[model samples]
Target: MIIVDPSSGTSPDRIESFSLESDHSIIVTSLEHHVWQELEQEIVCSLKRLQCPRLLDSTVLLLHKLITNIVRTMHRHAFQQAIEDDLNIDIVSKDNVFDELLQNELNTHGDRNIEQFCRKNHFQVTLTFPEKTDTLIRIEYPESCDSSAYLDSKLAKAIGFTLLKQTDTITPAYYCATVVRDIAQHHPHLEQAGHSELLLPDDESDKVLAVFCKLNYGIIVFSSAGDILSISPAILNNLKLEISPTSAHTLTGIIPGHFYNDVLWGLALQSQGGLFENYRIRIRLPHDDSLSILFNISGYRHHDMTIHTLWQIVSLDHKATHTLAEGSILNEARVHNITRNYVPQLVEQKAREIVRLGGNALLNEECRLAVLFCDIAGFTSYVENNEKEESVIHTLNMILGRITKAVRQHAGIIDKFMGDCVMALFREPHKAILAALEIHKHSYDFNNLRMRAGKDLLLLRIGIHWGKVVIGNIGSSDRLDWTTIGDVVNTAARLEKNCCPGAILISETLYEITAHMDHPEIRFSKPFYLKLKGKRNKQAVRYVQTTSQTLLHDIFTTHHAKG
Candidate 1:
């Protein structure tokens, strides 16, 4: 059993040195009532001694539930192993007999047999305090024991219940950390035992493809010989294509005359591993109306060296038609490069928005949004002082990656990244604050790594505000930038500029909205006034405080003392 004393000034590098420590180990050899009572008493005393009354009851209850389930599962496995050894046969082949004997022994003997069995196959539980803020419980089983059974059992349900019950009491960071840790521990077992191979069979793949073709876009599959193999109903309906008994089912015969030559040329180019996309054409409809369509073709080579072409046709709106008519269609190679490189950086919501809007027209609208700005403190000095340009850029990207992840996790849209700052927009005021908290937490870890490496620690200052903002395209005709504008954006930036290092500053407007919600993790100071730039009157604001602030301070103090 290993336990690190929180008051010992133990760093992460020294964790392995304390592996032999056994100050927090509890040995369980039976499930009898008196044993549980004694164990609970010890746990209660420990909690009291630690002065962690906030988590006392919940921790006790959760540990009890978890241990109960674990012990039961262990006993069942041990019993099966005993039967198999005595009978010299696989227990699965004697399921009925094993079940009858198991029931009789459990109900009649009442832990007498299981208690003796557990005495030979016992496990130890150890409790550790991580950063003196969270509890880490570990159960260690013997080499011959199968601990995976307990992990795969009802332990997750117990953890879930504890989290739900303590939602309003525990911090969000702790809650998320617990959930993620549990998932990571069991993920390998889940993949090996619970889930099947991810790749679908041929029939399943065909069924999926059939369903996918029924969506809004038109799909057509053809062979290298220009023979139409399959086409979606959407294609025929949207293009008003009618098939007669005498009509040939070939690309040349079925395709419209206006775009047949272009389609053929595109397919020929695709055969040489060249991409063909954004080929625009006009399809004449009834009543002299015309519809603009964009074509994207992809080719797949089969094992038999046969090429299968997949053609996608998207109908364009009036705005997209005008934009395309202005000769703005990108070259196929540029389109391919952009899709492969830049498109993946877009968030899922932004990607969907672009697809829905057909990537055309000015998206000018006024909506109430929460704006967040995050800037790294002392970054300029660090960059100027550090001669290793590559290391500086790497560190900058690492920090920016953490901030980007936090915003994306909270469903916020990243507007842009300035030199040492990031701007994001969120629809929910509470989520924006949550994202800010997450960014600071991640930065704390980064700073710890930097401190250990004898590098200067980087701190972040964040600001969030909620108000109506204009979000749309703003730039020259050649290069348009999709961003947020209005006083709200300016206020968020100003707040960030005036914020203290390693802290978050939020306007009262945002504070009021989030304070009314069920977010006990977020705490704020008394209302304060700030003379923000470009404003006639002082703006009302508050300093956002979190439990992590204390943790960060402890780390800083400990590191500096050691230095």
Candidate 2:
């Protein structure tokens, strides 16, 4: 097995160069550009255009793969140029924004607009190839203009599989070094990408602090006076520190050691927290003189309240020049299964996680509630006759937008949207009824607006019921939905199906709760014992129809008052 060692720029700057006794002639070259501006532009433009939250990962991966392929092509071009210096070797770079990689996704997936598809649902993405090759390529994409947070290994792997033109998998160290390089150069923009906290010392002891550091990675410790207390062979070799560790080696004895004390002691004395205690420094190479290695210094306190610093080292060159050879790789179905599972998992772990609140959802609570279900009248026919997908979506969104505003105005929360239907919940029965009334009142105007625009007028039906409900987030641990679920929820759906167009139907439980309200314009249809679908017994319910609004109040005023 090839082991990782921090290097001083002999190999490419992506992977830790490995040497085996049998094959020692491996040559490496670093491609000197963070090219592919076309892909970056597409990423920035299409970010807002995407609809589903899960597809965000795929979008990033697609762009990353594009850059990776270009880089691989550049690496091969560099090799050919350096060794062969051929009479004529043309790469013929294309300017098309959606080039070969994107075209392959279109052909292999479908003819739909990739951006629009991403807008509708979570699309599966697998940059990892089923076929294998020996060469591995590493790529790094900027997370943002000002953040140290970069995408993790899974993303790097996806880019590797898709763009390592002739590789089985991306070697980890190759890509991780890209992260290290980024952190070093952009020290001001720290990588706070997710909730992963930095290593902390539990006990207030410098020795105990070093205990945890050694468990994680190699570390070198030094006193506040800049004297070396302990050293790890890995870090010492990586930095090529000339000073012999005699427990009295002042940090200033070394070259860039002047900043070493400031970085280590200054932060440690200022704050007891992890945020300010971290620092990055680069050391010039003894051999090349022009090249350097980056080291990360972190500070901690001992039981005696003494400040101690830790040193972690990484190589500057991370790129790799893999020798192409045949190897084993996964199949297409395996890749599909892998991709299908991964995108959703990422959404659950990274996207849904509330970063500020430490992954805890804010809407977890129980309350008495009024559930409302509303659906479009003859929606199936509207969809079936709709020839243009964009038109159908536009019309549907227009209606939902109006309905959502009405509910929100009346202190109701839209639980979820189901195709041409929505389920909302309210804590007050009057507010729920008023929300339904708001929909009826505004729809007439909505239909009129559509008619003037030469569009067919659509109708809506609403059903409401009130009962005790756990009005918070509930679902699988990873995927949570902020909605309510109880027997009363089902009854509201049943009432909506029984409701007529422009009518607000409510269960008897809801009627009894709101019967005390002194609303002059509100009138209920004759209360009758009706056997709703799937119910064995008859139940008391009422249908609320539009009478008149003598109050002449706006939708906002009606919400705060009786309807």
Candidate 3:
């Protein structure tokens, strides 16, 4: 235990001695009110000299309550004896004699009796100032008290105290009071609940599960009658909702019109003892853009037979696949038991692994990688000329989705989506070229669908380049994106911009690797020198045309004639 001595001046030894003596200890003997009053006064004086003005009052009250609880737990038999001794006197027969005798005995020998009890029961209170960044107040129970027994007792009922349980091995038993800063940092809601009184959670398992869901997914818990019990902050922020005390929000109020019915159906299925997992739905956003969301529902039966439900919402935007792990589903019969028993162990293991492996060591690296860029040709003009923004966006997403699918199918990483373009990275040059060819073929299929729907045909332009690029996390500490950057990336973007619609372009470096491969369905244009933007010298490139190129051109010609 250590504390800075404000009074000791010019002598390090004196300061160290004062700090050592500053630790305060009190022995609990009986539940007599006067004993605690004197002890509280001593503690208050010591706190006053400690110079923590902001926390002085709260700490004093907290310590008093904690000590009182300790006394009540350890001195229950002594209290019962005192009360029984008082009850022995018959008040109706000799009230005056009883009062005088009891007062004399208590006044003369109460302190001696308390001292004897203190020696019998090994309960003592000690205040030690540990060297820590944050202020802390902790209570250590006697070795005889097991962790469960201590936690079940009144001493552990205080809110904002973390229980460090004892084990058969090394970990000792203690529960420490949460300092003000710790509370604000870890449990901000408790501060808003007010400091006058603190409330403990009814069930610790529920608290653990709530935290896990809040961190990993956007979750909403509903009551039996569909009232909103709790909702994650991410959901509120994503949906732009304002929940207040006076107003109420319903499912219909928060969810988009297109996806609301699906959500309702999911809830109904769960209520009927059915499992709903990965129920995919599309939600249209402003500007006619849409988001792919997957809903998973879990249900719980309360002691009163009321059925409650929890909805785990995961956004599938930019994800390569739309699916959830089978083991991730919460088991209806063992959800509580599993979460209570295993979640903590899982969290600890993950933390240790992260520490063992330097957190960012694997994510950031320099390697030889392939960069591919795909853009919709004339998308800006299409959006401006098309009055129905919905159709324009729908067409845009269709093309982008096709490109994303092709990239993922070829084992490429989708770095990011920029407006109408997607940037992806791959390890092998052949895979990048293959993915580009696949995307080019899919464009023709998309055009056929548009032709049937009486909508204008859209074209796609793709570019591929292979070179040494630094692929790692970029952005501020708070928000980061795993992306690639180098001359290779810029060159790919330029190639995409220069390529004609319905064609795939490759840089000389990338073409060298695939030029020898036998892709009978693909036709490579003669290698030519083209001046690319942001380059001092002209770049050697070739346009790779698939077998569907002629069909795409025929469709374009027919569409122009129809228009």
Candidate achieving the largest lDDT = 1
Clashing pairs in 1: none
Give each model's whole-structure lDDT. 0.60, 0.52, 0.56
Could you tell me the lDDT of residue 468 within candidate 1? Answer: 63
Superposition TM-score, candidate 1 onto the true structure: 0.45
Error of 2 at 324 (Å): 37
Models 1 onward score TM values of 0.45, 0.37, 0.39
Over the stretch 365-437, how does candidate 2's per-residue lDDT look in tens digits?
3335789999987788768876474388888888888998999899887777899898887756789998988
Q: In model 2, where do residues sit more than 4 Å from their true spots? A: 1-366, 452-454, 471-475, 549-563
Instruction: Please list the residue runs of candidate 1 whose C-alpha ends up more than 4 Å from where it truly belongs after superposition.
Output: 1-351, 354-362, 554-563
The best candidate by TM-score is 1
- Candidate 1 residue 480 C-alpha distance from true site, Å: 1.0
Worst 10 residues of 3 by lDDT: 12-21
Per-candidate alpha-carbon RMSD to the true structure: 22.5, 24.8, 28.3
Backbone N/Cα/C clashes per model: 0, 18, 0
Candidate with more favorable, higher lDDT: 1 or 2: 1
For residues 364-390, write the lDDT of model 3, one tens digit per residue: 334456789998887787788785645
